[model samples]
Every structure is written in structure tokens, then in C-alpha cells.
Target: MLGRTAATPVNGHSANNNPNQLALPVNLPPGQQSEASIVHQHIQEISNKRISTLDYLRKAHEGRVYWFNTLLFDKSDLARMPYFDSRRLARRATNHLFLGLSLPSVIDVGSCTPLEFLRSLNILLSEYDAFQQLHAEHGSASSSLSRARLPQMFRRSAPGSKVRRTSNAAEVGYPHDGGDGGGANGTHNNSETTAGSTLGGGGGGGGGNGAAAGSAAATASAISLAASETELLPGEEYTHLLTPSIPFEPDYFETFATLCDVLIDTYQRLLTLVPTPRECAGNGVAELFTKADGKLRKIIIQGTVKEFEDASRQGVKTEVANVAKVVLGGLIST
Candidate 1:
């Protein structure tokens, strides 16, 4: 009877297969240096396979950023406390998808579609309406503001004018002055004028100090119940003073601090994990096992996820020629 020799295979693959297959030099193909690290070995493997990992990474981040970007659309979700919208904020989603994907030099985005432009627009409009409706029902409860049961702060409705409780949102009125639009003096003057005229306009008997003192007291109380950031107009629902909403939250505003913090924390984690260009360099491409059919899934590195995301969002056509040079040592294509 013939005995199996060392060259015999238990399966179609060499019996020598092991997780450390990358560490062994004999398994490495030609062109890989003897001093190759696990990363370098994988690079050589990818080179032999010729996969398009760059396109996958680019599309992945593009998909994620598409959603994140739409979320950033101005006042898209204004009613939620901790509202966050900004390019910098969108960076986190882009970073996280790349880092969590086992980013070796070679990437294999086996099969997936990049996020679409139309989907991004739909997300923005839908979320904006949802957040606003949430506010209409729950008011400050959903906003980052503590559940202070704070009385509705509004710009006082002028006497004989529509006393309808106006919301800070539009439908109440057109946008306020093209700014934060609030000041201590302006707030004081308006509250006093409205209170005196509306409550005791004709009761001018002899309450000089009394009326003055009462008016001052009322003004102070109103100021405390609501912040002095904007003039509050009276409304049936006790709407809080509405300030101008912008399409993007700048870096400085304190009102959106919680939202900003969420983005900051997310981006910080992604930043910590992102690979440097040198580390991401791969010799070529490699095979990762697929879960569905237990078959080898090829991964290739074309560029960094960031490079792909920026290019896709900007609508630049990324040509793949000469990608190996860039992935191996040159600057990642943007």
C-alpha cells in the first residue's frame, strides 16, 4: 500500500495552512523581502491577487458620510437637544468604518454599493420633519435642556395684536433678525412695555413706586424663567424664545454643546484608531474567508478610506491606474 508523503494534501489546500501562514517565509511568493512583517507578507499576497480594495474603502466611507452629511443639514434635527451638524462631525463616521474593517495593507470590499446622493437628500428632509414634530409634542423635554418644566418663554405679543402663543419655530413668524438677536436691555424694555400696557395700562391712580417696582419685578421674573438670549412672544403653547436657526452649527455656540460633544467623542475615537499612510501601505492584495460560503474573499488596498470619501463627495472621478505605487509608498490618492 502506498503511504501518504509530506507533499500529500488532506484537502485541496496545502496541509501546511495555519493562521500564522503569513509569518512563514516559504509560503510567501517571490518579491517579498525575507525580513517581511505580517503586514509586508500580506502586501505581497495582495500584489499577487490584484484586488481593488481602494474602491471598496472609498465607497464605504462615502456611504457613511452621505448619511452623516445629511444629518448635518441645518436645523435638520433642531428640536433634539445636543443637535450636531458639521463637516468635522461627519469625519467620525468616515474614520470609524475604515478602522473597524481590519485595515491591513490590502482591502477586499467583496461586494457593496457606495452611498447614493439622492438618499442623502431624502434623509435630510425626513429627519428635519421628524425632529420638529417631536418638539411640537414634547417641547424642551426632547431638547438637551433639562426637564425644568420651564414655563414657555416667548416674545410678548403686543396688546390688541394677535395674542396667539407663537412658537419659536417658523409658522410663528418669519426668521428673527439675522443674528442671535437677543440683548438684556432690549429684553427688559420690551417685557416692561408689554406688561405695564397689557395689565395696568389705565389703572394710573397713584402707584408710582408701586407700578415701577411691580414692573421691574415682573421683568426680572420673566428673564429668569426664560434665558435672555431672545425676546419671547406670548403664545398659547407657551413657546420658548426662538432664536435664528442656521444650516450649520458653528464651532463656538454653547447651546449645541451636548451635540458637539457627541461628535467630538465619536471623532476622537476614530482619530485614535486611524492608520497612518505608511502603516496602511500594502504590497498588493489578500484573501479573507467569507462567512456566507466559507470561501476566500479577496481584499485589496487602492487608497485610504478618507481619500476615497473626499473624492466621492466632491464628485471627482478616481482613476485607478498606478494605484499600487500610491498604496505601497506614494501619497494616497485624494
Candidate 2:
């Protein structure tokens, strides 16, 4: 085959040159090798941090979905109570506000690209659709039912019962221009005046006086009963209801606790791979170290908060309180 490709040179060098004359493979110095290793380590550290950040985001999103299911979807009887419906609406609004505020923070720290961000938002929207399905299925149609009764209910009642109707003209005197103030009857058109004068200028004096006294007495009794019942106001009851009970949702707590454990484990692994400052200096890996450090700190903070939130949901008030104390201490120290 073309004289065996001209009997190709063994080392691809001129046949005249000695075998020893062939260039030797370059050997990196120990320092350079160390530097390379450090660079590799730093890269691994950053990659690990990025992975952990993604895990955090995924866990947080999952926790949000679980929270929605536990708080809103699970309570079948919640729709029966008007107060609960109002509370649910308020809770939904509050959750939306918190999520909107916190989501940007997570995205910023994670450095999520636009497509990734949109994907996360889409997941949230899908979760929201599920939440709305629960709401629609359970929500009271009181407003619609109330509206249907409006016309007949608003119709004036016959002369009887608690709410009495009186013409505004009779209540506050209006000038009558017609002579004698009489209609077709021989009777005086001053029927209202006659009734008022006969009662010593008090149309329903006796009955009105008794009703007022009874209302005052009843009000006083109600006040006393309420005072004796509890020192808390109705609004206070609502506030307390919003405060999650300790050991609240055991399953929710367990789920987030597992997530926290994963974060801690990942963080430890990342720490092991981090390059020292000296190592970082020689290999241009210093920036990665700094980034990893920042990300680690953020992960710790967010993980702690998530743990606390889960604990609170499970009615582990002590843990929640401890977390709050830690946060306060951090703020104070800072």
C-alpha cells in the first residue's frame, strides 16, 4: 500500500536523530501540581454549593406545597365556618406576600437564570392551581345565597315585631300645604299629630321606654358574661388561631427536618472540598472560595429558618421559640 506509507518513522522524528534526542514529557513541579489540585478543589466546592442551592430551592418549593395541603386542602370542615373562610383568605394573602418577598432573595443567592426562574414560578403557579381547586370545592356560597334572599327580605314588614317602620315625614315634622291637612275622609289629615299628642308627645312612649331599659340591661349582662368568659377579644382569638400550635403538623415537620439534614450533609461535604486561602491564591480559585463561603452562610440561615418553620407547624413551639431567639441573637450581635 504505497510502500507501507514510506515505512513511517518510529517516533515521528528524523531517522538521523538518536532515540535519546527525542523531547521528554514535561513534568509539573510539586507547587504547580498543588496549585492545580487547589483549583480543582475550589471548582468542586463551587459546584457542590450550586447543587446544594438547587436542593434547598427544591425542598423549599416542596415544603410550600405540603404547607398548602396541610393548612388549606386538608380541612374539609373549614368551609362551614364564616370566620374560617375569612381567615383562609387572609392566610392566603399573607402567604403570597411572604413568598413573593422571599422568592427573589432565594433566586438572587442561587443566581438562577431567567428560564430557571420562570420554571420555578411555573411550579408555584401549578401548586396555586391545586390550592384554588381545594378552595373552590370547599368555599361557602353564602354571598350568592344571601343575594338571592335580598328582594323579599328587604320588603317592608307588616306592623309587628322588632324593627318598626315609620315615615320620615312623621318622624320629623314636614309642612303640609293643603288646607285642613285632610284627605277624602272627614277626619283630620293630622293622624300622625293626633297619635303623637295622645301619647303626651311620645308616639310609642311606654313600649319604647321599656325596650330601651331592657336593651341596656341585656347589654350590661352581655358585657359581664363576656368579661367573665375570657379576657381575650374576638380579634385576639383570631390572632391566636393564626399562631401555629406546637407539634402542629408532625408529617410536615418530619419532611422539612429531613431537608435540613440533607442541607447539613451537603454543607459538610462542600466544606471538605473547599480550598484553603493559600491554595486559592496560587490557582486563581480565591473568587470561588469567597462565593462558596457566601452561599454556605446563606444556606445555613435559610435552612435554620425552614427547620423552625417546620417545627412550628408541628406544634414544636419550644424549637420555634429557640430559633426565634437565635435569629434575635444574630441580629443583636450583628
Candidate 3:
């Protein structure tokens, strides 16, 4: 109540239009519930400020999209042109980042454990498989495909404004240094080497005594063969995950968009618990609210601007402009 009393209301049209601006929890639709939404409700309830995860993400999505579009988008590619103008990819990526950082639906944020991360990862891996299938079938040339459904991303760096593989992919850096496969407890590697064996029996025994003994021997032999089928070395059980070496379509950015959706759904369900900050009352659920709320904290990027830009890159200047706007929120053009 004290925090609520100290909070001042933001009176822009953004605030005035929403009826739940004053409510602790924005009313959910008929029988619908979202854990991320609930966490946001608590933040608004405690902050005495008109803050909502939904609202915050909207602003962030706007910024993220602006930056992505400004940096990516092939002017000559007519099919991709609409997608670039639409800016849906930015929103989609922001959603995944937020979900990945938040607590899941059924569980509270505090309950997030190492096991939960693995579960979340498994879901994303499944998403990767599905995305690959879709691209394999129709390619990014499919008219129905959205920008958010792409397989690759337009990173901030590189030789020109070319798109690159995101970290979520198995071979993020084109040529993978395959010293070790997935050791993390997420999923199995590129091949699920399941071993099986069979047993054989002979009918040579003519009498009762010989028949029973022959059957026993045959069964023993069958068991021995089955045991030799697949023998994994020590600690190899959890280390093997199938990392599919799927090549990317020309429009991989669009592919990344689709795959990111799968990751968003899975990650949004996980709950990561951290100690409550002093300014905000402990929601008790331990989600990293800051991560969920902040925008432009991208995961699929690396290197500096100078390191990645080259003579052929025409869009680096525009990319710089987009980043400047993100910092200023449409303030200046220097």
C-alpha cells in the first residue's frame, strides 16, 4: 500500500486507453491464465507505477523491430520486402527473449530448477526439428511464411549486413569446432543410436528330456546376443545429443523467426528465481523480471561493429541509425 501511494500515474494516451491501468491484475479472458502475465501483474501491484510486462514488451518490441528492420531487409528482394516493412520479426524475437528469461505458466518462478531448464531446452530442440522440416518442404519462398518464422538472423556484426546462424542453432558459426557434442542435460545428439538384438532356437531335440535342455540353451544364447547389442562407455549416456547439420535456406532470417516462436513458448514456461530487488516488493516468484521487461538484449549476436563491417556492406550506416534510435527511443539522428 505504501509503494502504491508513492507511485505516480503516467497520463499519456498509452495509459488512458487501458481500463486496467489502475487494477492490480489485468483481468484475464474467459478461463485463460498466463504465468508471465501474472508476474507482470505483481510488478505493477508493487511498483505503484503503471508497469505491465505486456505493455513493456510492446514498447520493447517496437524498438527491437525498428532496429532489426533497419539493419536487415533486402531492398531488391520483393518477397522479403513486405516482411521487412512489417517488423513482425522483431516482436517475435523479443517474445522469445522474454519467455526464455521468465517463469513458466503452471509453475511459479521460484520453482525453476536445473531440470526445468533441460525441459525447456528439449521443447526448443523439438521446435528446431519442426522448423527444419518446414523449410525443407517449402523453403522460405513459401508465400504463407512470416518473417518471424525464419531460420537465421541478421546479426549486428559481420562482413556487410548478411544474416547469420543464431546461438540456438547447433552450428552457429558455420564451421563448427566439434571437439565435444552437447554435454548439457538438454537433449540427445545428432544420432539416437538405439541398439537391439534377437535370439534363435533350434528344434533338433526329439524327446522330452533333450527338448527342455535344448530350449534352455537356446534361451541363454539369445540373452547373450541381446546384451552385446549396444554397450555405451561410462558417462556417455547423457553426453550424446543429435545435433542436426541442416543447411539454411537463402531466407534463413525468416526461418529463425518461426523457430524462435517454439523457443518462446518453451522458455516462457520456465521460472528462474533470483533474490528480490529492494525497490520492488518480493513477488515471491523468482523470475528475472528485468530480463523479461528490457528490450534489445539480443542473444544471437557477437563481435564489434568495426570487426564485422566490410567494404561491401551498404546497410551499416542505417544499422547504426537504428541502434541510436533504440538508445534514444526515436530522439536523434546522429
Candidate 4:
């Protein structure tokens, strides 16, 4: 038999023809290996894709807003755009479709539906109800004195009444005990004692702790009564008193605080939909329409959530922040 050369295959077949033949190995320099590894790492990084809910919503909103802004600047372009019902849009939904697939960048939204909206609304409403309950309790508890004084206040304000208008008028000023200074002083001293007991009774036995707790509750009631007597309404001042002056053993105004937090989170999330000034300036054709109830069928940027919120932050701090807060807070958490 003929001797095989270095280029010959082990079996009598050429390297290309032999299935068992292995390809020659090429050794790369350390530098080249590192470069190759880096290239591969970059490729892997580029292939991996993920997006946050906020970013997704923002992109969808941006697309929608840009689309609208474009339409606002051009009239003839409407003939080229697709038409849909106004009620079909879901701001948070993927592609803004209330019940359909993604349309396009401008008209399409990410995955969100009416169910999500309802769930969010339920949570917000529940929180709001809890807040209302807590607020009512706080108000009723604190307003006992005010309600008590209502009779005296009404009597004084009655037409042609003999009650003097003095701030210290016995009829109106100290109406708790028939306007007796001694009675007022006695009640005041009793309140002080109760408050002192509540505060100073900390280092006591179990029974003493029980007594202290009772005294604390009594003190809160009495102080609230006194504040009410002084015309301190259920407002920021009252809430302030409740915060540090009284221990929040029962979570204090935590419901209200929670509502506020919820409102803030909702607003921040909504801000994601606010188009950049640049986006607002673009122009395009429009074909989107809302359910026909009022004017011609088409989308319009009427009073938005921002406008509603701006109008709602005008009153007492202890109360609700804004209408948008309540409505939007109930619609979305994130």
C-alpha cells in the first residue's frame, strides 16, 4: 500500500470527503481572544431587551401625543389617516386599544386593559373610603366641643338675642358649664391632670400601663374637645395637633397620608404621558375620533388631567389634594 502523506485522511478519503475528519484548529493571540470575547459580550448585551412599565407607558403616550400633535398642524392629512371611535382609546392600554391588537406607533399601546383600570380604580376607591372613615372619626372626635358649642353659637347669633358678642361672653365663650369661670377652670385642671397622667405614667406596671392608656385616650378626647371649643376646626391645624401632640397609637391620620401618597404616585405616573414641548409642536394628519355625543367626530386635547390637578390643589392641606388625584389615583397605582 502507498504511504499516506500529511495532507491525506486517516481512512483513504480526502479530508473534505471524510465525515470523521476534523478541521484544523487556528490559535488566536491573547489580545485577539480578549477582543473577540468583548465583541461577543456586546452582541449578547445588544440582544437582551427589557423595558419598565413606566418607560413603556411613556413611549406609548409619546407616540400618541406625537401623532396627535402632527395631526393638529395639518388639515388635508386627515384623508390619509385611519378613523376610529374615541371610546376605543385606552390611555394606559397597549397601543391604546380598548379591545384590539396594536395599530401603529402613534395609535398602538402596550399591554394594559380595562380590567387593569378597574382594578386600579377599586384600590383607590377603597383607600379613599378608608380615608373618609378615618377622617370622619378624627373630625367627629375632635369636633365634639365645636358641636357642643353650636347651641351657644346659634343662640348668640340669633336675631335680637341678649347674648353679648364679646369673645369672652359667658353665653358664647364658656358655654360648657353655664359660663361659670370656676367650672371652666375646674374642667381645665381636670384635663391637665388627665394629660399629665397619660404622659408621665409611662414607667408603670401592667395595670398602670392600662390606666395610662385609658388616660391617654381621655386626654385626647378632652384636648380635642377643648380645641373644638376654641373653634379649631378639622383642618391642618387640627391634623398638626393630632400628629405630635397626640401619639398616633391608632395610626393617626395614616389613611389620609396614604391617600396623599397614592395621589402623588398616580400624578407622577400620569406625568409620563405629558408630551415633551418638542413633541407638542409637531404636525400630522388625524383620523382618530371619540364617540359621537357633542361635536364632529375627532380627538381633541381638551382639559387634561394636568388641568384638573392644577385646579384641585387650591384648598386645605389636610383635605383632598385634587380631583385628578382622587379619580386618577383610583385608576392606576404605577
TM-score of every candidate relative to the true structure = 0.18, 0.23, 0.23, 0.20
Q: Look at candidate 1 and tell me the lDDT of residue 35.
A: 30
Residue lDDT tens for model 3, 1-334: 7545433243221323333433322343333334435554564443322223223323322334222233432324322333333233333333233233332331333234323344444443344333333332222324234234433321111211222222223224322222133122122121110101112211111113334434444543323221111112222122112222222212334334443443344334332221122112223332443332222122221111221232114456666778887989755654
Query: Tens digits of per-residue lDDT for model 4 on 1-334?
Result: 2223323442232444422222221234466445544543432332121112223223323333222222221223222223211211111111111111101211223213222222333333333233222223223323454445444521212211232211232223222332123221222222223344456532122222445545655655534332222332233231101111111122212222232233334333322322121111111101000111011101111222232223223223323456668878888975
Pairs that collide, model 2: 245-315, 246-315, 246-316, 247-314, 247-315, 247-316, 248-314, 248-315, 249-313, 249-314
Q: Ten residues in a row with the worst lDDT in model 2?
A: 239-248
Going through the candidates in the order shown, the clash numbers are: 24, 10, 27, 12
Task: Show where candidate 1 strays beyond 4 Å.
Answer: 1-157, 163-214, 221-260, 266-334
Flag regions of model 3 displaced more than 4 Å.
1-72, 75-251, 267-284, 287-298, 301-334
lDDT of 2 at 300: 36
Question: lDDT of model 3 at residue 103?
Answer: 24
lDDT of 2 by residue, 1-334 (tens): 5433433333233422422212211234567657656665765656576566546544543444343333321233323434334434343333233223334433443322222332343343343333233222122213443234323322322223222221122324423333122332212212332333443443233223445434433433322221111112122222101121111112322343353454445435434433332223243344444543454444334544464355436544555778899999999999
- Where is the poorest 10-residue window by lDDT in model 1? 290-299
| Error in Å for residue 229 of model 4 | 20
Q: What is the C-alpha lDDT of each candidate?
A: 0.29, 0.36, 0.31, 0.27
Select the stronger candidate by TM-score from 2 and 4.
2
Q: Compute the lDDT for candidate 2.
A: 0.36
| Model 1, span 39-101: residue lDDT tens | 434444443332333332333433432422322212332222232234323322222222232
